[model samples]
Target chain A: MKTLIVVSHPEFQDSITQAFLKTSQAGLDDVTWHCLDEIYGSDPIDIQAERELLNGADRIIFQFPLYWYSAPASLKIWEDDVLSRAYTYASEEGHLKDKELGIVTSVGYPKSAFAAGASQSFSISQIMIPYEALAKQAGMKFMKPLVIAQFGYSTDEEKSQLLVDYQMYLTAKYPFSFNERETWMIQQLKKLASGNMKNHQQELDLIIQELETGQDDLNDLKEQINLIRNKEED
Target chain B: MKTLIVVSHPEFQDSITQAFLKTSQAGLDDVTWHCLDEIYGSDPIDIQAERELLNGADRIIFQFPLYWYSAPASLKIWEDDVLSRAYTYASEEGHLKDKELGIVTSVGYPKSAFAAGASQSFSISQIMIPYEALAKQAGMKFMKPLVIAQFGYSTDEEKSQLLVDYQMYLTAKYPFSFNERETWMIQQLKKLASGNMKNHQQELDLIIQELETGQDDLNDLKEQINLIRNKEED
Candidate 1:
C-alpha cells in the first residue's frame, strides 16, 4: 500500500540521525514523508488539505520520539484536527475507512526500564495505548509500533540495526496475528532448545491442556487480543 | 497557580456531557482552556503563539476524552510541536524549564478494565508514559492526572461530584509529589479507621506497632494509587 509518514520531530534540520533515516526512507518508492511542523507552520490546519492527504494515502504512519509517554504537541494537535475531520467525514458518509495507521517512536530509556518490576512501571506498547485508541477511532489498521530504545546510548551498530528493524517494520506485511502470537512464541521457544520440545514440553503440554480444558477462557483471551489487534482495522 | 487546560475531544458539540463540563470550565479563573480541534481547525500551530501561551501559564493541563487508550490526535501534535521546540530552545538557550504539567482525561470504559489481568492490561496513566517522560525532560513537575471513568455511563451524581473534584484538582495548592504521597495516604487512612494517634492511646499504640514493624507496603501502594489518581487529573 502507498504510505504517508507524518514525521513530527521539531528540529528536523538539526537531527543528523533522523535526517539520515529519512534520506534512506525517502529513497523508497510508494511512500511520502510529511514533516508536520513544516507543513502547518503557525496557522490552523486547513481541513480540506488534510482530508485530501488522508484520502490519497492507504497507510498513515505517525513518526516521532516518545516524549513524556506520548507524542510531541504538534502530533497531538494533528490528531485533534485531522483525525476528527476524518471521523466527521465518515459519520456523514464513510471515507478513508480502509487505510492503516502506525507509529515510529524513538525512546530514550533502556528497554528493561519499561518492565513491570522496573522503576518506569510499564512496557513501551503499554505506554502507547493512546495511539492505539486513535487508530481505532479513525478506522485504520493499527500497525505494531517501531520502537527505538536508548537512542542516546546506542552503539553505531545498534543504531544501524534499529534503522534496519524500523525499515522492516514499516515495509513488511505484519509479523503475526494476536491469536497466532502464542503459538509463534511456543514454536520459537522450542526452536531455541535445539528443536526439542522435550525440555519445555511439560510447560507446552500444560498450556495445551489449559487451552483445551478451558476453551472458554482461551477463546475469550483470543477474542480480546483480536479486538485490541483489529481495533484500528475495523 | 494559573493553569492551562488543553482539551482534545474531537466532537465537543454533539456530546452534551463533556461539552457541559467545558462550559462549566469556561468561567473558572486562572485557567486557559484550549479546546484544541475547536481552535486549530486541523491547521498547524503557530510556534510563537504557543510558546507565548506556555510562557504565560504556570501549569499546563492536557485535557481530553480517552480514545481507545489515549488523548486525541491534535494533542499529540501539540506536544510534538511545542515541547520539541522547547527542548531545542533549552538545548540552545533555555525555556519552559520550571513549568508544571498535568492531564485531565475522560474515559468511556469503567475503572475495572484497567486492572492487572483485565481485558486492557494497563491503567490510563500507565498508557501515558510519553507525557510523564516529557515532563521530566522539560524539567516540569508532572502532577497527578484527573480521570473520569465510564464518563458516558456515569450517573448524574457521579458527574456532579466529578465536576467539583475536577475543579478542586485544578486549583489545589498541593501538587501530588512522590515524596509526600505516602505520608498523605497514611494521614487519610488514619482519618477513616483510627482516631488521631496523639488522642487515642490504644489505637495509637497499635498503629505505632505496625508503623514500627514496617510490614505494610504503604509507600508502594500509595504510588500506585497516586498514579491512577494522577491519571484522572490529566
Candidate 2:
C-alpha cells in the first residue's frame, strides 16, 4: 500500500527526533514523505496537487513533533485549503474513502506525565481523539498512531530503539487499543497459543480460548462464552 | 481570571466570526485578544514576548480556524518557538503550571463527518489530543474546545449568531471537567438537548440545563446520562 508521510516540523534541520524519523523512512518503496513547511515556504499551498496525493495514497501518516500538543500549521492550512466539504462530501467528488490514516508522532515529554497527578492531565488516546474524528469525516480508516514520547530527553540508544519499534508498528495490522475492557481482553488472549489450543485454565480461559482458536463447537465468540459457562456449571 | 485569547486567522480583518468575537471580547475587564497573524506578518515570531504573554495569563485560549485538523502556522510557530522544553518545562525558571489552555476553532466541515461512518477519520478531539497532552506537561489544564463547523458555508444571520455564541463560549466560566470524557459527555449532553448543537445552540440556559446546573457532578456524569435517559424515556 502506498503511504504518504507528511512531516510537519517547522525547522526539520534542528529537530532531532522528527528529522531522524523522516530519514529512517527513506528508501521505503511505497512511502512518500512530504515536508509541509518547506513546501509552503514561499507561495500559496498547491491544493489540487495535495488532493491528488491523498487521493492516491493508501495510508496518510502525519509525521511530526508534538508542538504545544497539536500539529504544526501546515497541516491545518492543508486541511482547510485542500480537504473541502464541498468536494469531499456534498458534490460528486468524494475522492477520499476507505483510505487509511494515522499519525507517527515524536513528542519530547516523558510517558509518566500523561496521567492524573502527572504533569499532563490526560492519556495519549484521549488527546488523539480529534484526529480520529477527522478521519471518520474523510471516510478513511483510523490506524493506530505510532508515538515516540520524550524524544528530546530520551537517550540516543533509546531513541534509536523506538525508531525501530515505530517502523514495525507502522506495518502492523492494528497497533492501538483503547478502553479498559478491550485492553484486558487483549492482554488475556495474547497468552493462548496459535500453535495448539488446549487446556484452558478456567471457564473464562475456555471461552476466551474457544473464541480465539475456534474450538469447542462454538462458531462465534458469544456462543463460545455460553458454552464455557454451561461447561462450568456442569 | 485573566484570559489571553490568541486569535490566529491569516487575515483577521476579513473574518466575520473571529472579528465579531474579538470585538465583543475587547471591552471585557480581564480579556486580552492577541491577533497572532497580525503580530508576525513580515518577520519571524517574537518568542520572548509570546512567552511573557503566556506567563501573564491564568488561561490561554488558542483561537483559530480548524485548518486541516489543527490551527494555523502562526500558532505552530508561536507554540514551537515559545514553548520550548528548555524554558517552559525543564528550566530552572518557572513552568506553565496551574494554567488553563483551550481551543476556539472554526472549520468548513459539518460536524457529522467527524463520526465513525463519515469521511473524516478521527474526531476533533483525537487531532487535538497532543495539545491537551502539551497543556498537561506544561502543568496546564486543557479545557474542552469551542468548535464552529461549516464556517464559511453558514448564512450571514447564522454567522452572526455563531459569533455571539462563540463569544459566550470563550468567556464562559465553565467548571473544571477537563478530559475528553467529560468534554464528550458535556458535548453529548448538549447533543441530547438539540439536534443543531454542532452548528448552533449557543445560549446558556440550554447548555446549563443539560449540565444540571453544577460542575462536580459532571465528574461522574452518570447523573447526566440518567437525566437524559429519563428524558428520552419520557
Candidate 3:
C-alpha cells in the first residue's frame, strides 16, 4: 500500500519529535513523507496536485503536533482548500472511498493526562472526532491513532520502541495485528541482514529463526484448541 | 460586560449568515465584532494587539462557519499565533481566567443530522469538545454553543428567533436561565421603546406593563411556594 504522510507543524524544523519521526520512516519504499509547510510555505496550495497525491495513496496519514487539541493551521488550510465537497463527499464523487485515514499526533502533555477525570479531561479519541467524522464522510476507514506523548522526556529505550512503532504505523498492514507486525519485523530483519549490516547477519538469522519457531508453536496451539472444540461438537 | 467576538470565516464577505449576525448585533454598545480575516487578511496576526483585545473582554466568542467539523483555518491560525503559553495557562498567568468562552457556529447540515444514527453522526457538543477543553485549561466558563444549522433553509420567523438567540449568546448573563432571558428581553424592549421606536411608545408601554405584571405574579407564586416549604419544614 502507498502510504502518504501529510505533516503539518508551525515549527517543523525545530521540532525534535518531528525530526525523529522523519528519521524513523526514512527508508520506507512505499511511504511518501510530504510536509505541508516545507512544500508550500505562504503560497496557495495547489489543490489539483494535492488531490492527485491523495488519489494515489491507499492510506493517508495526518501527522502533526497537537495544537489547541487539533492539527495545526497549515493542515487545516490544506483541508479547507484541497478537499473540495464535490470530491470528498461520499454520497457525491467519493474520490477517497475505501481508502484509509490515520492520525499520528504528538502531544505536549503526559499520556495519562488524557482521560475523563484527568488534567486534559478528554480522551484522544474524543479530541479526534473531527478527523474521524471526515473519514466517515469520505467513506474511508479511520485507523486507530498513534499518540506520542512527552517525546522530549522519553528514555533512549522508549525512543527505540517509538521508532519501531512509528515504522509500523506508516507501513504495516491495516489493523496492525500481532501476526502482521511479527511478519513485518522479520522482513525488516532480513533486509538488514542482506544489506550493509552483513556483520550482524548471523545474530539476526538466529533471532529470526527463534521468532519463526515461536510462531509455529503458537499456530500449533491454536490448531489443537480448534481440534478439541470440533471434537466436542461432534 | 464587554464581549469580544473573534470572527473567523474565509469567505466572510459573501456569507448571508454572517451578515445577518452582524446586523443583529449592530446596536449593541458593549459588543466588539472583530473579524480576524478582515483585519489580518493574509498578513501575520498581531499577537500583542490580539492578546490585549482578549485581556480586555469579559466574554470572548469564537464565531465562525464550521469547516471540516471545526473552525476555519483563519481562527486556528489566530489561536496558534496569539495565544502563547505564558499568557493563556490557567495554572500560570491565567490571563483568561474567570472570563467566558462562547461559540457561535453555523453548520451546513440539518440540526437533527448531528446526533447518533444521523447523517452527521456527532452532536455539536461532541464536535465542540476542543474549544470546551481550551476553556477548561484557561479557567474560563464554557458557554453552551449557539449552533445555527442550515441557516439558508430557515424561515423568516426562525431567522427572527435566531437574531434574538444570537444576541442573547453574545450579551446575556451567564447560565442563561429563563428568568435571566425574560429580564434581558424586557430590558431590550425598554431600550427600543425609549429610542428610535418611540412612535410606538404607547403600544410598547402596554406590552411592557403586561410583562411586568407577569413577572410580579411569578414572583408572588415563588414567594408562596417558599412559605409553604418553610411551613412544611416547621
Candidate 4:
C-alpha cells in the first residue's frame, strides 16, 4: 500500500520530536512525506493537486503536534480548502472509499495529564473523535491513533520501539497483530544476515537469539496457564 | 462585561449563517466583533495586538462555521500564534484567569446528523471537547456552546429565537438560566414600550402579555401540584 504522511508543524525544522520521527522512516520506499508549511509557503493551496495525491495513496496519515488540543492551523486550512473539495468528489466519485485514515500525534505533556480531573480533562482519543467522524463522513476506515506523549523527553529505547511501531503502522496489513510484528522483525534480521554485512553478524545473531528466547518464554507461560485450568477442572 | 467575538470564516461576507448571527448582536456597546479573514487578509497575524484584545475582554467567543468537524484553519493559526503566547502569560500573570470561553458554531447539517450511527457519528458537544479542554488549561470558565445546526434552512421563528439566545449568550452573567433570560426579555419589551416607538406599542404589549401568561401558567401548575400532594396526604 502506498502510504502518504501529511505533516503539519509551524516550525518543522526546529521540532526535535518531528525530526526524530522523520528519521525513523527515512529509507521507506512506498511512503511519501509531504510537509504542509513547506509546500504552501505564503501561497494558496492547489486543491486539484492535493486531491490527486490523496487519490494515489491507500493509507493517509495526518501527523502533527497537538496544538490547543487539536492539529496545527495549516492542517485545518488544508482541510477547509482541499479536503472539503475532496469530500465532494468522494461523495460523487467514491474516490476515498476504502481508504485508511490515520492520525499520528505528538503531545508536549505526559499522557496521564489527559483525563477527568487531570490537567487536560479529556483523553487524546476524545479530542480526536472529530477526525474519526470526518473519516466516516468521507467513507474511509479510521485507524487507531498513534499518540506520542511527552515526545521531547522520550528515551532512546522508547524512540527505537517507536521506530518499529510507526513503520508497521504505516505499511502493515489490516488488523495488525503482535505475532505479525515479531515475524516481520525476524524476516528483516534474516535478510540482513544474508547480505554482505559480515562485521555485524555477531550482533545480529545475539538479537535473533533473544527474540527466540522471548517467544519460548511466552509459549511456556501459555502452557502453564493451560495446566492450571486442567487442575481446576479435575 | 465586555465580550470579544473572534469570528473565523473563510468567506465571511458570503456566509448567510454568520451574517444572521452577526446581525443578532449589532449595535451592542460592549461587544467587539473581530473578523479574522478581514483582519489578516493574506497577511501574517499581529500577535501583540491579538493579545491586547484578548486581555481586554471578560468573555471571549469563538464564532465560526464548522468545517470538517472543527473551526476553520484561521482559528487554528490564531490559537498557535496568539493563544500559545497568551497561555505563557496566563501561567505567570493569570491573564486568562476568571475569564469566560464561549463557542458559537454553525453546522451545515441538521443537529440529528451528529450522533452514533448517524452521518457525522459524533455530537457537536463531543466534537467541541477540545475547546473545553483548552479553556481548562488556560484557567478560563468554559461556557456551554451555542450550536446553530442547519442554519440556512432555519424557520423565521427559529431565527428570531436564535437572535435572543445569542445576545444573552454574549452578555449574560455566569450560570445563565431560563428565568434570567425571560426576565431580560420582559425588561427589554417594557423599555421599548416606554421609548418613543409608538408603532411598536401594540406589538410590544402583546409580547409582554404572552410572556406574563406563560409565567402565570407555570406558577399555577406548580401550585396545583402542591395542592394535589396535600390532598393525597389527607
- Name the best candidate (by TM-score): 3
Q: Is candidate 1 or candidate 4 better by TM-score?
A: 4
**Which pairs in model 4 have colliding backbones?**
none
Write model 2 residue lDDT over A6-125, tens digit each, in one string: 777777778777667777776455778788887877467898888888878877888777666667655665666677776664234667677778888776667776676766666666
Worst window of 10 by summed lDDT in candidate 3 chain A: A210-219
Off by over 4 Å in 1: A85-98, A116-121, A150-156, A176-234, B1-62, B65-102, B107-145, B148-159, B167-234
lDDT of 2 at B161: 72
Model 1 gets an lDDT of: 0.68
- Per-residue lDDT tens digits for candidate 4, residues B140-185, read 8989999998877889999998998898898877677766677777
Best prediction by lDDT: 3
Which is the leading candidate under DockQ?
4
Tens digits of per-residue lDDT for model 3 on A99-195? 9999999999999999988889899999999999999999999999999999999999999999999999888887888888888898888888888
Give Cα distance to truth, residue A34, candidate 1, Å: 2.3
The per-prediction CA RMSD against the true structure, in angstroms, equals 16.1, 13.6, 1.7, 3.7
**Once model 2 is optimally superposed onto the true structure by TM-score, how far is the C-alpha of residue B29 displaced, in angstroms?**
3.8
Q: Which 10 successive residues of model 3 chain B have the least lDDT summed?
A: B80-89
Please give, for residues A144-227, the per-residue lDDT of candidate 1 as tens digits: 787777676778898777765655555545654544544544443444444455777777666765544455577888899999
DockQ of each: 0.26, 0.35, 0.83, 0.84
Q: After superposition, how far is residue A168 of candidate 4 from its true place, in Å?
A: 2.3
Q: Mind sharing the TM-score for model 1?
A: 0.54
Of 2 and 4, which scores higher on lDDT? 4
